[model samples]
Target chain A: MNNPASKRKPYQRELPVDWWLKHAFYTKYMIREGTSIAITIYSCILAWGLLRLSQGPEAWQGWLDALQHPIAILFHIIALGLALYHTVTWFDLAPKAADIWLKGKKLDDKFIVIGHYAGFVLASLAALIIITL
Target chain B: MSHTDSTKLKRSHEPVFWGLFGAGGMLTAFLTPVMILITGILVPLAIISPEALSYERVHGFATSWYGAAILLVLIALPLWHTLHRIFHGLHDIGVKRGRDWQQVICYGAAFAVSVFVFTLLLQML
Candidate 1:
């Protein structure tokens, strides 16, 4: 018995390593995706902080003190920019995910986008206030 | 052969991960900037006072169930979103090898940290 299933060849498109850099549109898409790197790093830092917190006060303080380093500050600044970029891109695509209807007509996408922005602003303010207080 | 065919549908696990991705993305979009602003930039700059994040206060907060929940969510949930993107981003950047292992490592990292944080919180409580 002979099996014929092993003879298939598929066409794969040639994608350049710098393909995204070739166009503004693809560049923006990659940048939006790249924001994940910063977010992932930030999550690790927070996880590390939690571990430190689980240790004694001294360990926790050490983690806090490290945040004051210049490199940490610089990383945070860049991460902030990328995170904001993620926010913009996410919100721009929010309407498709949220298909709310008002009466018989579909709700305006602008309204949903604006509502997300409003919610984001309020949540940020609430966090700041809670932490400071 | 037709009579042996079952009508039951095969379930895909994609929705569970996708749900986590959506929730994490929403949280990251809404809260991550302000978090970075407070912990990374403002407090470290001493503009918001480092005492605001003093060890005593943070410890007290983490000791509470609500606070522990918040901490776990903030620290771990976004990993689901970010790592999902990073996994896909690898493909976009032309990483064509080990696709299965790529997914495992990506989601595995997120799960490991989540359990780590949860255990720490449980110990604290």
Candidate 2:
């Protein structure tokens, strides 16, 4: 059995089912990423809204009414929570993705985060103005 | 390693996925909560009337090229982001099955929906 061709390597163990559960950080990380479910749901709802647009006013109104229903409202409430989680986590992780070098020194992470918040405020204000007009 | 050896090292195609994920992440951070606020809270509470988001007005917006562009980016980017997360998440969660299949199913669905939205919006124009 000790032949050169039959030299066996040690079997590599697969990751445990509860690998993430073992660490608080990993669990939080998973939760953050998993919130994408909310985004997916919102996307589907919006996509369906687009389809309803093609149909007629009645269809689109029906879609709106559906959203106003208790169940849809409840789902949206949960989606809001998940959406907020994603927003916070995304902001937290933004600095790692961006590597802007200003005047030979690395730009600070706090500034990157602050810049994102500032941009969000500006964009949201602009959108609100447009929508209200 | 020499330049030639480094050149021979094939890079992962992950950066493309990560790029979309990053863009989507940024978009999500900016827009998702606001959207939920507008749709979920404001309209429902009648603080912002349903008329603001009525079928006619929204459809009118969609018919415009600019409106279509905004709508497209809003929906499409988050989708790629979500699918990208789900695809990687499967591995993180110790799902030992097919990674390729997972990737195709995740991003493929996002791509499919995006096309569907584009085609439907185009028809309205």
Candidate 3:
């Protein structure tokens, strides 16, 4: 008699390496999520900046000057694109992740999305004021 | 079938990790773009003067209490977010072996870097 385990046929479906490429929504989601890499790079660069800062003026100046290099400029451009994508995607998805209800009714998704953008604008203005001060 | 299903599920303490990831992602979503706008695009393009981020000024800011806090949050939490994404992305791309090790390596790097950043930030303060 065959063992019961042997009698059972397991279903195996291989997940594609580029699974996100299979559909539009998935591709968008993956790209949005993938922007974190650029964010991570910026974090590392900032850490280096902090180290240079700790070493005093000359070191920090050198680090700042490095940012002016063509290569650095190019990297920054890439980072900018990624950052924009991440920001937009975050606002777009906030409603889905945050289940907000009011007066025993589900809140509108648009309000959630708009609220994110509005808050972002306010924060950006605040940061600008602080930086410029 | 029920027994097999039950046996397969080892209760995962994912909420804690996910909480960190959410916080990091939220922070990144708002601040990072503005950062890029100022430092990367505006300054580099000379739309905002390069002197805007001069060594003396930035260093002074970094050594301040609030600045240290901001820098620590900006630098550290997002690393956790990125590593978490990469960890899950690996699984999404069908990394079939040693899931435990993958998680450890990913989150371990985030943890180590966060500690390192925290220490460095305190030194600045």
DockQ, per model, reads 0.85, 0.70, 0.60
Quality of model 1 by C-alpha lDDT: 0.94
User: Candidate 1: which docking quality band?
Assistant: high
Tens digit of lDDT per residue, candidate 2, span B33-68? 878777766676677878888877898899999999
**Can you list the residue pairs that collide in candidate 1?**
none
Could you tell me the lDDT of residue A12 within candidate 2?
A: 61
| Each model's chain A TM-score | 0.92, 0.82, 0.83
Tens digit of per-residue lDDT, candidate 1, span B16-62: 99999999999999999999999999998888978899888999999
Residue-by-residue lDDT tens digits, candidate 1, A1-133: 1245767566789999999999999999999999999999999999999899889889988998899999999999999999999999999999999989878899999999999999999999998998788
| Model 1 root mean square deviation, Cα atoms | 3.1
- Residue B113: error of model 2 in Å? 0.6
Among all windows of ten consecutive residues in candidate 1 chain A, which has the lowest summed lDDT? A1-10
- The residue pairs that clash in candidate 3, if any, are none
Best by DockQ: 1
Query: Whose lDDT is greatest here?
Result: 1
TM-scores for all candidates: the values are: 0.94, 0.88, 0.86
| TM-score ranking, high to low | 1, 2, 3
